[model samples]
Target: MGPVSFKKLLLVFLTGILFMSQSITVKAEAAYLKSKDVTLMNIGTQKVEGKIHLKGDSKQKQIKVLLIKDEEKKWYELPLKEGKFDEEIWLTMGKGKYTAAIMIHEEGRKYSYGPKITVENVGEVNPFLVPVKHVESNDEKIIQLAEKLIEDKTTDREKAKAIYDWVTGNITYDYEKFGKHQEGDYDNTYGALHTLETKKGVCYDYAALTASLGRAVGLQTKVVKGQVSSELYKGYHAWNEIYLADENQWIFLDSTFGVGGKKEYFDKKQSELSHSKQEEL
Candidate 1:
């Protein structure tokens, strides 16, 4: 071919290459944008379920689901498996009108929040009884100790009592934690496992540890907030109650009081102990 014909052919080849590159870039951008927005579908009162659809094959990345109650200004993080999650979103913080909101987080990405949902009359679906951030009930230490305590106990009541006994016997009240709490150290940074390791904690720690152990042994146990007015202690207190499924009743146990060898508090009526139950969960 002549030089002019060859130059023209070269120009045509370059133009074709640029068009192909632009097409590839557009497709790549479209794929990325598609994976960014996730549709979070609210299914029912106790749970929210959703799926994430991506254009490419799935690879492991960090995924988090947050439960935010705007009224109480309380929020919790729910664990997700792979890229999907379907689970209960709130604590068993008793019966009330609660606003539920969800915020999803992926690794290296901004959080995307879903619309606010209202939940009412959450009677006994206590999701907080399960392992959470502060209540590490699924931790190996708590699990092993719980297994040892309730090894041969076949009944739920028996297992629950065993856990209560272990907590009262092994754990001690931490005066230092109390002082720190008074000084505004409110996080209770050391949770169930740390409490087990140290064998000492304040009322909140005691309740958390007891709840952890109780849950590890498969008992419906929850940390309760209330007021205690006794000679030795008279202030806001945290305790626990175990649900006796067979008896169809909740039995209250104060491990903190029991730690001081006050057996009268075990399975005692909330009114009888001069304890006013505020938050049931």
Candidate 2:
């Protein structure tokens, strides 16, 4: 080819590549908004509101905002107006996480933007205060155990002490092996049966197992999630609350503490536990 023709072809190829690069950059950037521009606030009890500004070529299209509750597997969509959107979400006080997203429908395809919300425990309410439906048992072994632990002759304090001792002595705490993973089974009783059979579990598993066993024996029990600020450790922790039928109040029992090879026992009243928040069940 002639030198002039070759130079012209090279310039055309470079121009085409630059245009394609810009187009790709715009498309990639369209799916997400600037994170710093989004605003979120916990407005009132059980209510949170937020605003997200989305940037994209199809910004004029109708946008939908969703607040997804992980535990309940539910979604809440917000109303759209003009270029900005607002969302008001109602949440329960529990130990779980939530995610918020902005979705836009264009050319029959949907695109979503930043997940801008992370909700922790919202309020403080004892889980044991909620009414729990009693489960009747016909198993001979379970019935016999219940009868021995829950007979009319047993005082509330004695019953609670017995339950605490059984849980501490029977279950081994192993937190390292039971860290929460997104795909991990969390049927609330994931390790309960195994713990009952093998007598070993992590903090959460032990609390859940203890709660289940306590309920089986006709005592109201609940699992609580919180942060422990003891001398040895300071981080996320799990424990249980047992309703003292005679005293008409719930008491915190730390099976993990006992399982940690310590003689210290946690018979503190529910109000006395160092909990930033509490979630039921």
Candidate 3:
């Protein structure tokens, strides 16, 4: 081969190698740019902070993040800019796991990545900030019966069990029965008098009736909205948390489950009770 021809061939080969290397580098950069590394920090006192490091593409203009706390009824969204994002958020710290997702949007396309975190804040009591007043009823017979139950010679546990049993045995689970009346107003199904008279109601009705009766008997009770999940049943459910003076702990008693004649008492630890179900009642 001539020297000139050999030199030309060598130049062509070198040029091809450079082009291939550039192509490989460009592909690697593109893949790296499309994703990000996300770090979530639980900053204590019901606060959360997130750090995102985005490398590669400068075209990624905006990012959206969704944070789902433990038993949160809704997802909270935060907007972010390109390159890197550092944000702090106020969150509810229930005793359980939390999850968050980061979504990148550029040129009308979205990508999401999530990390799950189990937050352990046991032995925390989220006491009701406001005192709930018991609604006064005009029915004297109901009032008398309630007072009598309270005045009856029984231990606190016995009294709580009695009221729990009475509510469960009396009320029947009826979703169709309510038919969209205002909450706590069972005028269609049964008036306060009738509920007290017949001793039957839906979940809310039973809870209300139980609350009323419990209040009459001097027991502090709170009607909480959450789902009940057990070995037998799992779905949106309502139950009550009764404060027992003797035990000094909140006992979870579901009138619905108890009404169904199942003796499943969820005597969970304080940490376990903090995590409500994902659904809101």
Candidate 4:
């Protein structure tokens, strides 16, 4: 082929590629959510923030959000506290296109579909800080409690220790629930505020409560699931791995086992020693 003809063909191909890219970006941005029930605040970013409002006394109703990234799909149900929810949903599947669908939970596994908002993630964020399915890290109560726990404490480590001390001291183990759980008669317990209010819950609850409190106070905290190996306890366990940013260190703690601070599980790499994580999620 002639050089001039070849150059013209190359230019056309590049122009077509650029046009396709621009089209995808436009579609993503255009899908920013707005409806009578659901109002999405931001899109074309790593995470989307939104609010859900259900008219008239819908107690315990939840807004179920489904995030679709390629073939990967995950759902998070945000509770409708007083018939409303203000939630920030993350794009956990990393940088790419995502589709978020909002549905109103009617009953057991029943949901009424709503808008499907498309997102183009153009940013990155700290995962631990973002609230997930069970961890209501951004709740006012959680934030207030975190502030209360970390009061008069300096440094991230100290703040984390204060929160740890509170959980270990205040919350008690739910032996009955644990027994039922082992027998397959009970599902996992609820999240942070519920634990705080009840003051008794199983290991999952303990980990979630710890994560919520830690995240609220600006510490990067994650809930880890595994099986215990210690002679004291030898079954499934949930614990916390917290990042102390200033210290540039990660420490593991188990508040459930550390009831009354009797167990030396706090900041001792207890998760690594006592439990082995299941194959990666």
Candidate 5:
């Protein structure tokens, strides 16, 4: 879109286990591939990996982890920093075999493949709760902040609202990025940490940040890709769907509209919303 989009520690370790308590974490006794630079762990009967540890000493600034899964063979382009990368991943495309490999970005969106591994122990994991290239819910800073915001809140609504209020109140819309988007000058995949650190982003960043925060707090959340019919603007837009356990429902969240002290879009039933949800990006 005339656009944007959005780990850690898990290194916020307690929060992950809190949500995935029923998950079995076994060190599988299978014949696995070994690499001097890559280390994949917690390969048991679980939907999420404890962490995908990689040590790359590449000069390429655009190194990425390429993950492909299932019979659908969907490709998930994950962000990876040079030197050391320790982050959690999920088989969000349902329970199936997955493949992960290193990639060195050549230019544009082209990348060359590097060390590869096939993962086979993932169970049925919720895609919304899983962190991807954009919504990195497993990041430590996001995790710590989510915990801080929802400290005494026992209800999902309260916890989700805490994050909603913080994002809509603190983050300012980046008009400059919008200008560039109209000119089609940049890639629209800036992840959540960029919004958190800079405090400036577009609709995609807003949704990404909300999803990351919601998931970090143990609530299933997703960055919804869709179209908005708003008095202010329209066209391809991004928002959030947060699952509130007590209500047993997923609610719509649009912090972009809620910015500038507005509260109308914070928490509402998904059916009541007029937004057209295309998919979970």
Candidate 6:
């Protein structure tokens, strides 16, 4: 009960309060550092674009944004520079419904994951930049081919016809592989590069190569998958639908069935052909 005892007790109490406050602040800061804020800049029919505003300077750390898609159930990561990043971080994901989430990963470990953002098929995705697994539009060989093929072609239609001619003329149909694929003995390597290397492929490869080449030459192109009926049989087929920016119209091309540069399927309408569309990519 003495004055000195009272002073000592008061001093200890003040010190304990200060320590608790410091601990609380540290916890709050840690929580803040473990989370981030994301704002979508733009969402197009075919594109999902956004920016992540990080709380502190994460430049030195290996910060990345993770994009999870429903179709593939894959985690696609885009590295963040200077505490922020844009949609260019992700490779072109074609038109689809995607549940996208932004995550911060640092030092080989995931630090935080934001709420999932549902981005439906927006609109007008840039096909030139978006790439499927095997469809490498930016490949050196594809780029070279695109540049060379269009060197003399003047218009988009002309360029498209030229590409269609080259594919139908050069690449052969892989009936053997198609048979095997039908029997369920398939691998995941079919795309533009495969068709280019082998000079033969099924509908998937043909469509992918066409899209790749088309996109490389500054044309917006997509691979359309669905059913087509022919004299022999009715089955699944893959082809291309290219968007002519100048014409503002989407035209169809069937390079696989157009062997020998047949113009029957080129620029044809859906009602004119026995083709039913299932998906566009």
Index of the highest-TM-score prediction: 5
Against the reference, the lDDT scores of all candidates come to 0.68, 0.56, 0.51, 0.75, 0.72, 0.69
lDDT of 3 by residue, 78-149 (tens): 334564555433233444444445555435344555332333333333222111222223246656766665
lDDT of 4 at 141: 86
Worst 10 residues of 4 by lDDT: 49-58
| Residue pairs whose backbone atoms clash in candidate 4 | none
- Model 3 residue runs over 4 Å out of place are 1-139, 178-194, 231-233, 264-281
lDDT, model 6, position 52 = 20
lDDT of 4 by residue, 1-281 (tens): 99999999999999999999999998876655555366554443444333222222233346767778899888876656666665566655677677777776668667776656675665576778767667788889889989988889989888988988888888998889878987877545578878988998888898999999998878889898888877668888788889998989988788887883377677876447667877211
User: What's the lDDT for candidate 5?
Assistant: 0.72
Q: Model 6 lDDT vs. the true structure?
A: 0.69
Per-candidate count of clashing residue pairs (backbone under 3 Å):
0, 0, 1, 0, 5, 6
Give the TM-score of each candidate. 0.62, 0.46, 0.41, 0.73, 0.75, 0.60
Model with the higher lDDT, candidate 4 or 6: 4
Listing every candidate in turn, what is its Cα RMSD in Å to the true structure after a full C-alpha superposition? Answer: 9.1, 17.7, 17.4, 10.4, 17.1, 9.2
Candidate 3: lDDT over CA atoms?
A: 0.51
Query: Candidate 5, which segments miss by more than 4 Å at Cα?
Result: 1-59, 70-82, 260-263, 269-273
Candidate 4 versus the native: TM-score?
0.73
Q: Residue 138, candidate 4: how far off, in angstroms?
A: 1.3
Error of model 3, residue 161, in angstroms: 1.2
**TM-score: the better of candidates 2 and 6:** 6
Q: Which ten residues in a row have the lowest lDDT in candidate 2?
A: 130-139
